[model samples]
Target: MEDYYVHPTSIVDAGASIGRGTKIWHFCHIQSGAKIGDGCSFGQNINVANNVVIGNGVKVQNNVSLYEGVELEDYVFCGPSMVFTNDLTPRARYPKGHMGYKKTLVRHDATIGANATVVCGHTLGEFCTIAAGAVVTKDVLPHALMAGVPARQIGWVCKCGQVLDKNLHCPDCGTQYLFVDEKAGICKCGGGE
Candidate 1:
């Protein structure tokens, strides 16, 4: 008995692993070797390529394609038509398969807005926000708000996805932030450890 629900038009290959409570809606395809976590919701016209791994509680909106080498950590949000690429270069005659694919890691709680294109081999940090239509060409910092064609960090965002002021405070959630190292990102002030 399957614990997850896949719509009649969607196809889950034999070797795919879909966790309990996942809902794959219309016209989606989960290729072999793809692993989807529990509580994930994939909307219409989606594709989960081989070896792609999606973490738990992730919400991917309509028309998204998660290509191979793409890994979405827990609680990630992919808005409508967000594009994730695997290969940096391509040639129709000389196609490089998985060997040429570059890995992309989207850290926990990050939100990629609609129509954004995430280039291959970049790591999107935890809690980062990529605005719609932005093209990310580099690794993003945690809590950073990125926008524009070549997606540059415009500001920082709170864990609740609200923009932060220069004082590093969240207006919406009333959370204050203290800067940590590049690896640790931001920490709650007064040591909300």
Candidate 2:
């Protein structure tokens, strides 16, 4: 029951769990059974459905809806107006409840840009970046930069949010990645040099 901020205009259900320092802004609705971690921010018009779990330091921008079966790991960034689909097939006549909803996982430090659409049943790897307006149809590899329709891996990115150079180094933050194996993939260097 640590202190948190929920705007007067927002409605947080009785059984929802909000961690310390989290803020739910105007017009947001947090349903019962939702778990939000510390220092997270949910902007205006957001919806946190029942059974949803959001990890610490996550920043969810305006107009985002987190449906059931969706899990966001720590330090995840959900941009403005992004869409998350829980059901792949929809028939208004045939309704699929929470039991039918597909699970979606956004790993730690991932950035899903504004207006992006993440289809259900996919895992967005840690530190992956999904570009604005792109539609993610499959699992994204860690540190990969995805763009275009159906989202292809255009290049690799650094944890600092910069596209990695030819040497697999971050130009902005000085983070370096050492190529371990072509199959096993690159690993982040221990300390910034």
Candidate 3:
């Protein structure tokens, strides 16, 4: 028996692989060669393009598309209407096809907020938070809290999604983090270990 649930209006192509207990909701289209991991939830009007890989426990909200060359790691959250580009430059007349697509990787436990636009070729680091309406054009650091157009790292965040203080401690969760450098850090209290 099939392990996943696809809404009646959704179409999961024959070669697509959906893991156990995943739920694909209304108007979703999962193209051939897509691999979706266990317990993922995809909301309405979503598209999973060929070869897109979505990991376990991910949550993709309405109107999002996982295009070719985009990968979501485990427990990532994609908010409603978020955009992900696969090409740096796109022309209707001169299509680059799949060969020209650039990869955008959202690492484990990251959260991309509503209406956010993630340009191709960037990696959103683990536990990073992209605030609503932000435009991400470059790589994000782990635990960074990014906001604004052409997103900048305004602060750090905890694995539990709380903004961290300057001392790298989460007030909401009381988890401590240690900075390895200006751009990298790790949780000291085993929150994201």
lDDT of each: 0.94, 0.93, 0.94
Which stretches of model 2 miss by more than 4 angstroms?
A: 180-184, 190-193
* TM-score versus the correct structure, for each prediction: 0.95, 0.95, 0.96
lDDT of 3 by residue, 1-193 (tens): 9988999999989999999999999999999999999999999999999999999999999999999999999999999999999999899999999999999999999999999999999999999999999999999988889999989989989888999888888888788888788756555665433
Deviation (Å) of 50 in candidate 3: 0.4
Off by over 4 Å in 3: 186-193
The candidate that achieves the highest TM-score relative to the unseen native structure = 3
Candidate 1, TM-score vs. the true structure?
0.95
TM-score of 3: 0.96
Tens digits of lDDT, candidate 2, 32-74: 9999999999999999999999999999999999999899999
RMSD of each: 1.7, 1.5, 1.7
Q: Which stretches of candidate 1 lie over 4 Å from their true place?
A: 181-185, 190-193
* Residue-level lDDT tens digits of model 1 in 54-172: 99999999999999999999999999999999988878899999999999999999999999999999999999999999999999988999999999888899988989889888888
Q: Which pairs of residues clash in candidate 3, taking residues 3 or more apart in a chain or in different chains?
A: none
Better candidate by lDDT, 2 or 3: 3
How accurate locally is residue 36 in candidate 2, as Cα lDDT from 0 to 100?
Answer: 96
